[model samples]
Target: MSTSTAGRPYALIAEFETPASTLHAAELIRDAGYKRWDVHTPFPIHGLDGAMGLRNSKVGWFTFLGGTTGFSLGMLMIWWMGKVDYAIPVGGKPLFSPIFAFPVSYELTILLGAFGTLFGMFFLNRLPRHYHPLLKHPRFRNVTHDRIYVVIECADPKFSDAETRKLLEHAGGRHIEIVED
Candidate 1:
């Protein structure tokens, strides 16, 4: 609830001693109708996603679309080069044969699909983020160790300093901090 000199809150970070406590806190936050919140732990906790009301990721759709585009483009290029534009008649063979184009088309599909998966994950997850408000909190450094933390952004419509602290305490959080930007 504390604010910086400009009267804008950076973030609220609550520390928990164990994963169980953190998970419980996440459930409480979710039920409390807070949207801009996240939990941090040294390791992934089972059922955390469901407790946080997270939906399935959309990265797979990107991969599928990329592969489809690559396949279609490869087939079109082969047809254009071999049958339509050049119209090379080699040994009286068919101009556009599936057997001849399958290898290159398959390779392109796999290559593009792999690229799509990598880029989609990075884009969707907002990777390469060098800074975050929570990173300024002293205790947040323990996230890579044995500590668990939950952070609620001030951007949430229902956020209030007193109510957030009470919610964290009710969910078994301690050493709560009001981090600044």
Candidate 2:
């Protein structure tokens, strides 16, 4: 139930050269009933979603909520300003014409959506984090380069060093290293 930095005494890094291999390794680990794992790649892989067992990110929901809020606010502002606060007759038009507010409403939708998406991503991923346990491993720089690596944290309830290493090796991992905290 609790994960302490010092309590994380073990980790395993399985390095891969190609996205295909990385996907295969991820599938194998997932099928083995290992829950606490993450994979890294140099670029996006087409079917990696299935392999990684990742669901759709919640960023879309955040953006939708934000856009709705923005639209509501925009409509409220226009209604209050033009219809209630100061009603001005122009070209014999109604006070609350939807056509007149299209531009502002559209802009607000996009504005809020963008802001919400950015903030949501940061919040969900726990960004502004200056340091990470992954950074403690030396070979992990390959994540931004050509190599793909999968790591299973020792803190998982089902994690075991011997079993994880054997599974990775059986999955054709050529370079496997232990990550120390």
Candidate 3:
């Protein structure tokens, strides 16, 4: 395994030939007390998230909060404009009508909810990442074609170069590379 001049590892990446092998490797890694690990595959593999011990995403909460905020603001705007700010009496109608405010509130809710979902995904996923350590590996180039990769970062407390390589090999991984930072 390669290491930096300061004796710090960069990352350990393992290559698998099939999605099933990758899934098995992820499960092994998850159970091995390593926290900083990730899997990459050409296509989505069933049960991979569970194997990786990942929980549901938080983007839905962001969307719900944003929609609620938009709804509240829309209602406040309509009520204030119609009743307190400029109570323009139009054809003997009620100043603060729920029927009239419903459309604006609904539209604003949808708009803000969509924006929240989009931005939430971007933020949660750490988008706009210009470079990644895996991107520098030559075998990683086949990830988009028909390869699966499981990478364990050196930052994990349980990360030991010898043990990690052995674990990956036991989990049916091949072409293991000690990626450099």
Candidate 4:
């Protein structure tokens, strides 16, 4: 085992058969005063978000901000370039012809919203962290199949390996393992 996991003291790996069981395990673990834990599943389970105690994602807000910024900038650019800089008099339209700028603004809004959501999610989650001790565990490959796994890192202040194992066993997790970091 790598020394990176040595400092954690201990860690518990629990395998659950169903999404419902995984959700229940998470709730029980949280009630048991363990906070540093995560759930892995093949696909997103309905209502699992609430069970895991995750807050609403702020990516929507980021997308909205990006789209608004894009719309404003697009309008400004079109107005300055078409009306002020070039001064094109097409169909006797007004200098600040918003109708002509609608398409550009719309396109910019979509582009910004898509990119902003992608980058915002990555930023908020602090992702691209390819190396994790959990990835070293043998059973982790089952995550893509029929299994759901919950891992409680020992780095959490309120963890005792034996007690945590018992807690997981009681929570209906099967094939529980002690993972070394």
What ranges in model 4 sit over 4 Å off?
1-10
Model 1 scores worst on lDDT over the 10 consecutive residues at 1-10
Residues 1-181, model 3: lDDT tens digits: 2333443457898888887778888888999889988898888898999999999889998899889988988999999998999999999999998789999999999989999999889999888676766777788999999888889988888998899999999999888888876
lDDT, model 4: 0.84
Against the true structure, what is every candidate's RMSD? 3.2, 2.1, 3.3, 2.6
Error of model 3, residue 152, in angstroms: 0.4
The stretch of ten residues in a row with the least summed lDDT in candidate 4 is 1-10
Error of 3 at 105 (Å): 0.7
Tens digit of per-residue lDDT, candidate 1, span 31-105: 999998888888989988988999988999989988998898889999999998989898999999978999999
Clash pairs for candidate 4: 5-181
Kindly list the per-residue Cα lDDT of model 4 for residues 1-181, writing each as its tens digit. 2357353545788899987788888888777777788888899898877787888989998899889988998999999998889987878778887898999999999999898899899999788778667777888888888789888887777778788889999999988887776
Residue 26 lDDT (model 3): 88
Give the Å error, residue 50, model 2: 0.3
Let me know the TM-score candidate 3 reaches against the reference structure. Answer: 0.89
Best by lDDT: 3
Per residue, candidate 2 scores C-alpha lDDT tens digits across 107-159 of: 99999999999999999988877667777677998789888888888877778
